[model samples]
Target: MRPYPSRSYQAIFWLVFGGALAYCVYGLIVGDLYFVGKSGRGAHLHGVPAWCFTAFVTFLGAGVWMREFSTISSRYRTRFEILFLVSGFSLLVLGWNYSP
Candidate 1:
């Protein structure tokens, strides 16, 4: 049996996406970032929570990388996108969840 190119690429895309999603979710649940709060107010000025921003950026950055992948040859496209997304999301999740 032979595999379709598009299907194979899509499958790999999803595998990478799933890994990124799981990494973020784990950071969220285990890191207790939920309790840390997404946004809040104080006596002075209301401030946006950094974690929420990080999460947003990580998830959105994936889209940017995906777009770039379209211009590259197939040989490196999947590999680049996979590693980029996985590492980017993982770092974002960990950094967002961690606080000094």
Candidate 2:
């Protein structure tokens, strides 16, 4: 496979992908937020804020856009990039406001 013309694009792709994955793992390990334990009865886990869920979805979408940004055809590349930017910032803002 040919390399993307821009090294920076590749870097961005990996960064977003890795960041999203790490975030997921972190959430899981924390166990009180998004991750749930199967311990029987009275699992009084604090309800996660809606913004946290929104942020997670947006972050994943941004990662997808980053991964496909250079692979898609030119016609759709711009659209995807726009989606990526919008989602990325949406994720950021939602995350910033997120609280258990």
Candidate 3:
């Protein structure tokens, strides 16, 4: 495909995407203030349980892997990218619609 029309735009996208992935990854590990463990009170920002948030974060890992593969055009590892995109979307749904 064609390179980004603007290098700055691409840079911004990378920053945002990567940052989001990083945030979620870190959140999964840190959990939350009140939510200390499985028995603790897990908070829900938009409706998603903190545990589910962690699950969604795993998708970012896939996105990161795909980004590395795509950067070098290594064979057909594009599936990771697709997985990332789909997972990200699913995250939004869980975040917004999850009631329990």
The residue-level lDDT of candidate 2 at 42 comes to 39
Best by lDDT: 3
**lDDT-best of 1 and 2:** 2
* TM-score, structure 1 vs. true: 0.36
For residues 48-81, what per-residue lDDT tens digits would candidate 3 score against the true structure? 4555565565676566646652464644557667
Between candidates 2 and 3, the one scoring higher on lDDT is 3
List where candidate 2 sits over 4 angstroms from the true fold: 1-16, 32-69
Question: Cα lDDT of all candidates, in order?
Answer: 0.53, 0.57, 0.59
- Residue pairs with colliding backbones in model 2 are none
Provide the clash count, candidate 3.
0
The whole-model C-alpha lDDT of candidate 2 against the native structure comes to 0.57
Model 2 — TM-score against the truth? 0.43
Model 1 lDDT tens row, 1-100: 2333476666777677666556555555555323233578322111233344345556555654454435566667667667666665775566556555
TM-score of 3: 0.43
- In the range 1-100, model 2's lDDT, one tens digit per residue, is 4455577876876787676566655554665534445775532222344345535555556646555645666657667767766776766566556564
lDDT of candidate model 3 versus the reference: 0.59
